[model samples]
Target chain A: MANKLFDIIKSDLAELETALHESVVSPVATITEIGNHLIKAGGKRLRPAMFFLAARCSENFDLKRVMPLAVALELIHMASLVHDDVLDSAATRRGEATANAKWGNQLAILAGDYLFAKAFVLVTENGYGERVNNQLSRLLADLSAGELIQNKEIYKASCDTEEYYERIAMKTANFLAISCQLGAHVMGLPEKDVQALYDYGYSVGMAFQLTDDLLDLTGDSKTIGKPAGNDILQGIITLPAIRALETSPDKDELLSIVTNRDMTKEDLNRALEIVRATDGIDFTKNKVEEYLDRARNVLPESIPEDVRAAYMMAADFIAGREF
Target chain B: MANKLFDIIKSDLAELETALHESVVSPVATITEIGNHLIKAGGKRLRPAMFFLAARCSENFDLKRVMPLAVALELIHMASLVHDDVLDSAATRRGEATANAKWGNQLAILAGDYLFAKAFVLVTENGYGERVNNQLSRLLADLSAGELIQNKEIYKASCDTEEYYERIAMKTANFLAISCQLGAHVMGLPEKDVQALYDYGYSVGMAFQLTDDLLDLTGDSKTIGKPAGNDILQGIITLPAIRALETSPDKDELLSIVTNRDMTKEDLNRALEIVRATDGIDFTKNKVEEYLDRARNVLPESIPEDVRAAYMMAADFIAGREF
Candidate 1:
C-alpha cells in the first residue's frame, strides 16, 4: 500500500525536487553552496508529500499552482534545520557535515536568512492568497516561539509531560497541520473538510514526533545519522527522559546525569539503561499509537478509499520508521 | 525643516511606536523581553518614517490602512538588526546592549525570526495586496544577498568604489525605496508617481548610508554609541576607506592596517590620519550631495509643495547628520 501511494506521487515528488533546487539558486556562491549542501543532504520530504496527497483527495487540485507552495513548505523546513544546527552547534545532520560545520556560522546564518526570504518570495510570486501567506507567517511565529520555550526548558529536570507535548506540537506538529490544511485550501475545499484534514495532520504529526523522541534513546548512531542519546546530552529532555524521571527508581541519578552539561559516555549509557528499565519507552510508544489511531479516526467518510488508504499508510510509516 | 516635518508626523510616529511594541508580544516571555529590548533601544525609525512621508505625498492617502504597513516595514528593519548583531557579534547597538549580547545567541536567533514572522503577520492581516507582499519578500532577498556580498568583500583591498555603492544599495537603499513604494501603492497612486517616490527614496537612502560610512570613520564614540573606526577594525571596507585607498600616497600601509584584523590603536590612528589626509571624506561628501541632488531632481512637479519640501528636508537630514 505504501509502495502504491509512492507510485502515485513519484513524479510530483521529482518535480518538487527540481523546484527546490531552482528556488535556492543565488548570485552569491556561498549562499548557493550552503543551500545546496543542505538540500542534497535530504530528509523524507514528508511535508511536501503530505501536501500533494491532501491535494489528491480534493476534486479539483491543480499541480502547477500548488507546486511553488509545496516547494516553499520544504524550504521553510530546510531553513529551520540550518538555523537549528547553528543553535545546537550540531556538527552533523543526516550523517553529513552541517552547513555551519562546513562553512562558518556567519555564512550559515546568512544562508538560513536567504532561504527564509526566498521561501516567502516563492509564496508571494505564486499568488497564494492572503490567507495562506498569513498562515505561513503565523506558523513561523509558532515554530520560533516553540524553539524559544525549548531553549528555556533545556536541562531543567522540572519540565512536565504536558510541557513536552506542547513544545513538540508547536515545533513539529503545527507545520504538518498547516501543510495539510494548505493543500486542501489550494483545492478550494469546503472549510469543514479542511478542518478535518488539519486535525488528521496534527495527530499524525504528534505521533511522528513522539516516535522521534523514542528513537533518540533507542536507535543506533549509524542509523540515526548523528549520535544516539545526543538529545539528552544537549540538555533536550524528551518524553522518554521525562517519563523515566517520573517512574524510575534511579530517578535522582538519572536526573543528575541528564542535567549535567558534561555527561560522559558511561553516564549516557546509564541514563539510557534507567529509561529502558522504567516504562518510559513503552509509555511513549503507547502514546504514539494513540495519536496514530486518533489521526485515522478523524478522516472524513467522504474521502476516496485510495486516498484514505495512502494517509493510513503514511501514519503507519511514521509509527514504524527506525530512522 | 526637519523639526517641522517631525512635528507633522508626531502623532503618527507615536502610533507607530505603540504598534511596534504590540507586534512583538509573544507567548514566551523571553521572546518578548529580547524583542522589546531592541524596540526600546530606538533606531532612527527611518524606514517607517519614510513610509509615512511617502504616503502623505499621496492625495488619497489613508492613514489607517497605511499604519500597519509602516509598522511592518519598521519591524523588518528591526528584525534584520537583531540577526545582524548575531552575525557581527556586536556588543552594542544604538547605545544599548544588543539582543544577542543580553540573551544568548540561541534566543536571539529565535527572537529575530519571531519579529520577521510578525512583520508578515501585520502585512497579511492588514490585507496588503499581492504586489506589496511580493515586493516585501523580494526586498528581503536583496537585503540578505547584499549582506552576503558585503561579507565576502570584507578586508579585500581590490573592492572598487562602484562595488561599495552597489553593496550599500542592497543593504540599505533598497529597503527605504520599497518602503516608499509600498506607501504610494497603498494610496492607489499612479505608477509614474510611485516610480518617482521610489527613485527619491533610493537616492536618499544611498546618501543616508554614505553619511553613515563617513560617520564610522570620523564620528566620536559618545555620539555614534560605538567606537569610531570600528568598521575597519572588523575588516569592513567602507566607502571612505575605499576612496582613501584609491588616492592616498600611503595606500599600501592603509591596506595592510585594514587587512591585519589585529591592528593596534596606534595603527588604527595612522590609518585614520591617512584617510583624513586624502580626498576620501570630501569625496564621499560630494557623492552624497550628488545623490541628494538627483533625489531632488526626480520629484514630480505635480506633488504638493509641502510634500516636496518634507522630502527635500529628509535628504538634507541624511546628508548632514553627524551620527
Candidate 2:
C-alpha cells in the first residue's frame, strides 16, 4: 500500500516539479542562484505533497487554487531552511552546501528574503489571497520569534516542557498547520472543514517533529543526509532531551555530560547510553502517537476514500521517516 | 506648509504608535530591548507619513486603506536600514546606535526579517490584496538584490553610470514608487492612473536619492543625522563621485582616499575639498533636477487639486531635501 501510494505522489510531484522550477525560479539576480541551489538540493517536497493530496481528498477541490498555495508552502519551507542554515552557521544541507556556506550570510539572507517575498506573491496570486497571506505573515513572524526565543534559551538545562512545546509548535508545527489550512482554503472548503484540516495538520506536524527529535538521536548521517548529532552539538534540546531530563534519576548526571563541552568520547558514549536507558525516546514516540491519534480523529467523515489513499500514506511517511 | 504637514502627520502618527508597536515592533524578539530602541530613537517616520498623508489626500481616500501600506513601506525601509548598517558596517544611524551595532549581525538579520514579515502582513491585510502584494514582493526582491549588487559594485570605481542608475532605481526608488501606486490602489483608482502615479513616484524617488547623494557630500550631520563623508568612507561611488570621475579628476582623487580605516577629520576635509573643486556636487544636483523634471511630467492629469497638493509637496521634499 505504501509503495502504491508513493507511486501516485511521484507522478503528481513530477507535475509540481515543473511548476516549482518555472514559477519560483527567476533570473532576477543572484537570488535565483541561491534559490535554485537550496531548492534543487532535493529535500522531500512533503508539505506541498500534502497540500496537493489533501485537495484531492476534498469532495469539491480546486487544483488550481491549491497548487500555487502548495508552491508558496514549499517556498516558505525553503526560506526557513535558508534562515536555519544561517542561524545554525551550517555549511551543508542534504549533503549539499547551504546558501550561507556558498554565498555568505548577507547573500543568504537576501536569498531567504527573495524566497519569502516570492511566497507572498504566489499565495496572493492564488485565490483566498487575503486570509492565507495575513496568516502566513503572522506565521513567519511567529517562526522567527520562536527561533530567537530558542537562541535565547540555548544551553539552559532547565527549559520547562510547556516552553519546549511552544517552541516546537511555533518553529515546526505552525508551518505544517498553515500548509494544510492553506490547502483546504484553496479548495474553497467550508470554514469548519478548513479548521479541522488545520487541527489535523497541526497535530500531525507535532507528531512529525516528535519523530524528528527521535531521528536525531538514533539516525545516522547517511540516513539523515546530514551530519549526525549536529543538533546536540548545537545545543538544541529536543523533546527526548526534555523528557529524559524530566524522568531520569540521573537527570543532573545526564545534563552534566550533555551540557559540558569538556566531555570526552567515552563520556559521550556513556551519556548516549544513559539517555537510551531512560524513557525519553519511548516517551517522545508515545507523544507522537497521541498527536497522530488526535489527527486521525479530526479528519472529516466525508473525505473521499480514493483521495484518502494518498494522504494516509503521506502521513505515515511523515511519522515514520528515517530522516 | 512643510511644518503644518509635519505637524499633521506627527499628531496622526500617535494613533498608529500602538499598531506599529504591536504589529511591527512587538513581534520582533527584542521589541522593547532592541527594536523600539532603534525606532524611537530620533529617526523621522517620513515614509510612513507620506503613506498616511497620501492616503488622506482625497475625498475618495480612506487613510486606513493606505496606512498599513505606509507602515509596510516604513518597515521595508527599516529592514533595509538594518541590513545597510551591516553592509556599510556603520555603527550609528540617526545619531544613535544601529541594529547591527547594538544586537550584532545575527540579531540584525533576524530583526530585519521580523520587520519584513510585519510589512508584508500590513500590505496583505488590505486592497487589491494580490496585485498589490505581487508588486510589493517584486519590489522587495529587487531592492534586496540591488543592495547586494551595490555592495559588489560600489567597490569598483570603474562601474558605468547606467549600472549605477539601475542599482539606485532598484535599491532606492522602487519602493517609493510602489508605495505611491499602492496608495492610489487602495483608493480604487483606474489602472492607468495607478501606473502613472508609480512612474511619477519612481522618477521622483530617483531625484530623491540623487539629492541624498549630494547632501551626503555637503550637508551637516545635525540636519542629515549622520557623519558627513560617510558614503565616501564606505567606498560607495555615488553619482557625484561618478560624475566627478567621468567629467573631472576629483572622483579619481576622492576614490583614492577611501580606505579600510575610518576616515579621519583630515581625510574627510581633503575629500570634501576635492569633490567641490571638481564640481561633483553641482553635477549630482543637476542630475537630480533632471529626474525631478521627468517626475513632474508623469503625474496623472485626473487628480484633484488638493490631492495634488501633497503629491507635489512630496516631490519637492524629495528633490529639495539636503539629503
Candidate 3:
C-alpha cells in the first residue's frame, strides 16, 4: 500500500529532493556544507509527503506553485531538527555526525538559522504570502516552545502526562497539520477540505509521535539509527515511560532510575524492563491505533478514491511500521 | 542633534516600545521573560529609528500602517543580538545579565528562535507580504553568515582586512541598509528615494560598526557597557587592530598577543598600547568620518527640510555618540 503511494508520487519526491538541496545553496561555505550534511542524513520526508498528498487531493494542484510550499515544509522540519540537535547536544542523527558535533555548537546554530532563513526566502520569493508566513512562523514558535517545555521537564520525576501530550502536540502534530493544511490552502481548495486534511494530519502526527517514542525503547540502535532508550537517557519523559511511572508495580524504583542524572546502561535496561513489564507499552500502542483510526475517519470524502486509498494505506503503514 | 531626532520621533518610539513588549508575549514563560529582559536592557533602537526616519521622509508615512514594520525591525535586531549572546557566551549585554547568563545556553537559544518567529509573525499578521519577507529573510541569512564568518576567524592570525569588512557589512551595514530600504519601500516612496536611503543607511551602518570597534579599544567600560579590549580578548580582529597589524612597528608582537587564546589582561593592555602607538585609531576615525560624509551626501532632496535636517543630525550623532 505504501509502495502504491510512493510510486504515484515518486517523481514529485525526486524533484523535492533536488529542490531541498538547491534551496540551501549559499555564498557562505559553512551553511552549504552543514545544510548538505543534514539533507544527506535524510528523514522520511513525511511533512513534504503530507503536503504533496494534500495538494494532490485538489483540482487546483499546480505542481510549480506548490513546489515552494512543499520545500518550505520540509526545510522547516529540518531547521527545527538542526536546532533540536544543538539543544540535545546530540552527536549523531540518522547514523551520521550532527552539524553541532562536526562544526561545533556555534556553527550549528548559524546553520539552523541559515536553513530557516532560506525556507522563508523560498516561500516569499515564490509569493506565498501572509497565510504561509503566518502559519510557518507560528509553527516555528510552537516548535521552539515545545523544546523549552521539554527542557523544563527533563528528568523531573513528576512530569505530567498532560504536559507530555501538550509537548508532542506542539512539536509534531501541529507541524504536520499545518503541512497538510497549507498544501490544501495553496491549492485554493475549499476551506472544508483544508480543515479535514488538517484533522487527518493531526491525528496521524499524534500517532506517529507515539509510535516514535514507543520505538525509542522497543527498537534497537541498528534499526532506529540511535541507541534504544535514547530519549529517556537524555531525560525526556515520553508516554510509555509516563504510563509506566503511573501504573508499574515497581513505580518508585522506575522513577528513581529515570530521574537519576547519572542513569547508566544497567539502569536504562532495567527501566526499559520495568516499563515493558507494565501495560505501558500496550497502552501506548493502543493510543497509536486509536489516533490512526481517527485519522482514517477524518479523510475528506471529496478527495478522489485513489488519494483516499493512499492516505488510508499511509496511516496503516504508520501504524504497523517497525521504524 | 540626536535629541532633535529623538524628540521628533518620541511618540512613535514610545508606541514602538509598547508594541515590542506586546509582540514577545507568549504562552511559553521563558520566551516572555527572556524577551522582556532583553528589551529592558535598552538598546539605542537604531534600526527602528532608521526605519521611522526613512518612513517620515516620505509623504505617505502612515503611522498605523508602519508600526508593525518598525516593531519587526527592532525585534529582528534584538533576536540577532540574543543569538549572538549565545554564540559569544556573553555574560552581559547593554549593562545587564544576558539571557544565557540567567538561563542556560539551551533556553537562550530557544528564546532567540522565539523572538525571530515573533518578528515574522508581526509583519505577516499585519499583511506585509513577499517584499518584506524576502528582504527580512535575506537579512537574517546575512546576519547568520556574518556570525559564522566571525566565529570561523576567531583566533586565526591570518584573518584578512577584506574579510573583516565583509563580516561587518553582513552583520551591521546590511541590516541598517534594509531597515532604511524597507521603510521607504513600505511608504511607496520612489525607487530613487529608496535607493538613496539604502545608500545612506549602508554608509552610516559601516561607520557605526567602525566606531563601535574603535570604542572597544579606546572607551571606558562604564561608557561602552563592556570591558575595554573585550573584542580582541574574544579573538575578534576589528579595524583598529587590523590596521595596527599592518602598520605598527610592533606588528609581530601585537599579532602574537592577539592570536594567543590564553592572553591575560596585561597582554591586552600591551596590545592596546601597541595599536594606539600606531595610527590605527586615527585611521579608523578617518574612515568613520569618510562614511558619515557619504551618508550625508546621499540624503534625498525631495524630503522635507526638517526630515533632512533630522537625518543629517542622525549621521553626526552616530559619528560622535559615545555608546
Q: Could you say which candidate leads in lDDT?
A: 3
lDDT of 1 by residue, A94-150 (tens): 888998899878777777888888989999888889999898988888888898898
- Error (Å) of candidate 3 at residue A21 is 1.8
Clashing pairs in 1: none
Q: Could you list the chain B TM-scores for each candidate? A: 0.96, 0.88, 0.97
Whole-model lDDT per candidate: 0.85, 0.73, 0.87
- DockQ values, each candidate: 0.78, 0.53, 0.77
- True C-alpha contacts between chains kept, each model in order: 0.74, 0.56, 0.74
User: Could you tell me how far off, in angstroms, the CA of residue B124 lies in candidate 3 after the best superposition?
Assistant: 0.5
Give one digit per residue, the lDDT tens place, for model 3 in B1-323: 22656677778888888888888888777778888888888888889888888898877788899998898888888878888889899998877898889999888888888778878888888887578888998898889889888887888765478888889999999999999999899998999999999999999999999999999999987898788999999999999899899988999999999999999999999999999998889999999999999999999889878778878888889888897
- Cα RMSD (Å) between model 2 and the true structure? 3.5
Q: Alpha carbon lDDT of residue B258, candidate 2?
A: 57
Can you tell me the DockQ of model 1?
A: 0.78
| Candidate 2 local distance difference test against the native | 0.73
Which candidate has the highest TM-score of all? 1
lDDT for each residue of candidate 2 in B52-96, tens digit (9 for 90 to 100): 554554468665656677767777888878877876667887778
Q: TM-scores, in order shown?
A: 0.96, 0.89, 0.96
- lDDT tens digits, residue span A59-153, model 2: 67655556677777788888888877887888898889998888887777777877787877777666566777788888887777777767666
Q: Report the alpha-carbon TM-score of model 1 versus the true structure.
A: 0.96
Off-target runs (Cα >4 Å) in candidate 2 are A1-4, A24-27, A59-65, A226-228, A253-274, B25-33, B126-128, B189-196, B219-229, B232-235, B249-277, B296-311
